[model samples]
Target: MSTFFRSSLRSFATTAKSAHHNNHRDNHKFLPPTSFLGSWEAPKDPKEAEAKLAQLRRDYAKQVKELRKEYIEEMELMRLEKQRKDEARREALRVATEERKRLKAQEAEIRAQQRNIEQQQFRETLLKERAEKLEYWRRKVKMHEEKKAEKNELLRRQSSMWVDEAEIEKQILDTVIATTHF
Candidate 1:
C-alpha cells in the first residue's frame, strides 16, 4: 500500500482499540466517573497520584530539554554557514575592486603614453617648420647678393665711359693751342 494509506490504517486501528478500552472501562460499576475516565481528582490516597504526576512531569521536562538542545545545535550550524557565505562574498567584492583599480591604472598609463607621443610629434613639427623658415631666409639672402653684384657692374661701366670722354676733350684743347701759336 501507499505510505498515506498505511498511516491512515494504523491511525484507525489505534482509535478502535482506544474506543474498545473506553467501553470496557465504562461497563465497570464500582469505579468513580473520574477514575474511569483517567482524569485528575481528589483521590482517596492523594500521595500516589502526586508521585505519578511528578514522574510524568519529569518525563515531559526531559523531552523538552532534548528538543531544546537539538534546536540550539541546528541554529548554530545555520549561523556558521551564513558567516562562511558572508566571508566568500566579501572576498569576491575585494577581488573585483582590485581588478577595477588595476584597470584604471592601466588606462591612465596608456593615456600618459599617448600624451608623450603627441608632445614628441609636436616638437618634431616645430623643428621642421623652423628649418623651412631658415632655408627661405638663406634663399632670400643669396638673391640680394646677386642683385648687389649686378648693380656694381653697371656703375663700373658708367665710370669707364666718363674717363674716355675727358681724355678726348684734353687732346682737342692741345691741338687748338698749337695751331694758334703757328
Candidate 2:
C-alpha cells in the first residue's frame, strides 16, 4: 500500500512539473530558465555528468584557495596599520611630556628672577632710610653746639661791665688829708 501511494505521488508531481513548464513555454516560447529543481534530474549520459561534476569541484577548490589567501593578506595589512598607529600615539605622548617639562622649567626660572629683583629692591630701600636718619642726627648736634656758645658769650660781656664802689671812696679820703697839711 505504501509503495502504491508513493508511486502515485511521484506521478502527480511529474505531471504538475510538466504542466508548469508547458504553461511557461506556451507564453514565452523560449528556452526554460535554469533552476535548482530543473537541474536536479539525472543526466542521460553518466560519463559526461561525472566529468562536469569533477570540473565544478576543481573550480570550487580554486576559488576557496584564492579567498583564503586574500583573507590572510588583508589580515597582515591590518596588523601593520595597527602598529603604525600605535607608534604615532607614543610619539605624540612623548612630545607632550617634553613640552610640559619645558614649560615647568621656564616658570620656575621666572619665579627665581622675580625673587632676586624683590630682594635687591628691599636692600636699596633699607639703605636709603638709614642715610636719612644719619643726616637728621647731624643737624640736631650742630644746632645744640651753636646755642651753648651764644650763652657763654652773653655771660662774659655782663661780668666785664661791673665796677667796685668801695675802692672809689678810699681814693677820695686820701686826697683831702694831703691838701690840709699843705
Candidate 3:
C-alpha cells in the first residue's frame, strides 16, 4: 500500500483502540503525573513536618545550583567554538581577497603588454609604408630626368643639321661653277 494509505489505516486503528480503552477506563481512576510522587509519609508532629520541608527545599536548591553550573560551562564552550569559527571565516575571506587581487594584477599586466605589442606593430607598419612611398617617388624622379636628357640630346642633333640662307646660296653657286669646269 502507499505510505499515505498505510499511515491513515494506522491512525484509524489507533483511534479505535483509544475508543475501546476509553470505555474500559470507566472502572479505573487516573491521577495526573505532576501530583504523583514516588512515595510520601505524613508527619505526625508539626516539628517533623517542618524539618522534612526544610530538607526537601535544600535538596532542590543544590540540584538547581549543579544544573546552573553545567549550563554555564556549556555556554562557555559554545562561545569559544563560535569565536574559533568566526576567526576561520575571516582568515578564509582574507586569503580569497588576496588571491583575487593577485589574479587581477596579473591580468592587468598582460593587457598592458598586449597593448604595447600592438602599438609597436602599428608603428612598424606605418614606417614600412612610408619607406615604400619614398622609394617610389625617388624612382619616378630618376625616370623623369632620364627622359629630359634624351629629349635635349635629340634637339641638339636637329639644330646641327640646319643652315643659314646666305650659306645655302653660296653652296649653290659653288656647285654651278664646279659643273661648268667639269
Candidate 4:
C-alpha cells in the first residue's frame, strides 16, 4: 500500500512539475504559487533533510490556513449578495401584485358602473313600453264606448216609434225610466 501511495505521489509530482513548467493554469489550484522550499536543494545529510522537511510542512500549513480564510470571506460575500438579490426580488413582486390588485379593483368598479347604466336604460325602456301599451288600450276603450253609445241611440229611436198602418213616430229619449216597463 505504501509503495502504491508513493508511486501515485511521484506521478502526481512529475505531472505537476511539467504542468508548472508549461505554465498551465489547470494545475494552479493544486500547486501553491510560492515554492515552499525557497530554492533550497536537498542535503546529503539525513539530519539536514529532516529539518528541511519540517520547515516545508510548516510553510504548507500556513498557506492552507490563509487560503481557507480567503475562501470563507469570499463565500460570505457571495451569501450576502444572494440574500440582497432575493429581498429585492420579493419587494418587486409585492409591488407588482399590489398594482395588479389595484387595477383589478378599478376594473370592477368600472364594470359595476356600466351595469348600473344598463339597468337604468332597461328600466326606462320598460316604462316606455308600458306607456305605449296603456295608450293603445285607452284608445280601444274609447272606441268601444262610442260604439255602445251609437247602439243605445238606435234602440231608443226604435223603441219610441209606434208601428201602425197610418203613422210612424219616435219620441225623444229623455230618461232611462220611461224606456223600460217595471
TM-score of each: 0.60, 0.47, 0.61, 0.57
Among all windows of 10 consecutive residues in model 2, the one with the lowest summed lDDT is 34-43
Q: Kindly provide the TM-score of model 2 when superposed on the true structure, using C-alpha atoms.
A: 0.47
lDDT score, candidate 3: 0.92
Shift of residue 58 alpha carbon in model 1, Å: 2.5
Indicate whether candidate 3 or candidate 4 has the larger TM-score.
3
lDDT of 1 at 36: 35
lDDT of 4 by residue, 1-182 (tens): 99999999999999999979778665456756675346778799999999988998898899999999999999999999999999999999999999999999999999999999999999999999999999999999999999999999898899777455334333333334466744
TM-score of candidate 4 versus the correct structure, residues matched by position: 0.57
List runs of model 1 lying over 4 Å from the truth: 1-45, 157-182
Clashes of each: 0, 0, 0, 0
- lDDT of each structure? 0.90, 0.86, 0.92, 0.87
lDDT tens readout by residue for model 2, 1-182 = 99999999999999999999999888886667766445555678999889878877897799999999999999999999999999999999999999999999999999999999999999999988889888888888888878877777787787666545776577666678778779
Error of model 1, residue 112, in angstroms = 1.3
- So what's the TM-score on candidate 3? 0.61
Residue-pair clash count for candidate 4 = 0
Off by over 4 Å in 2: 1-62, 141-182
Model number with the top lDDT: 3
Q: Per-residue alpha-carbon lDDT of model 1 for 1-182, expressed as tens digits? A: 69999999999999999999999998977944564355556557779878878977897899999999999999999999999999999999999999999999999999999999999999999999999999999999988998998888888887777657678888788889989899
Task: Give candidate 1's TM-score.
Answer: 0.60
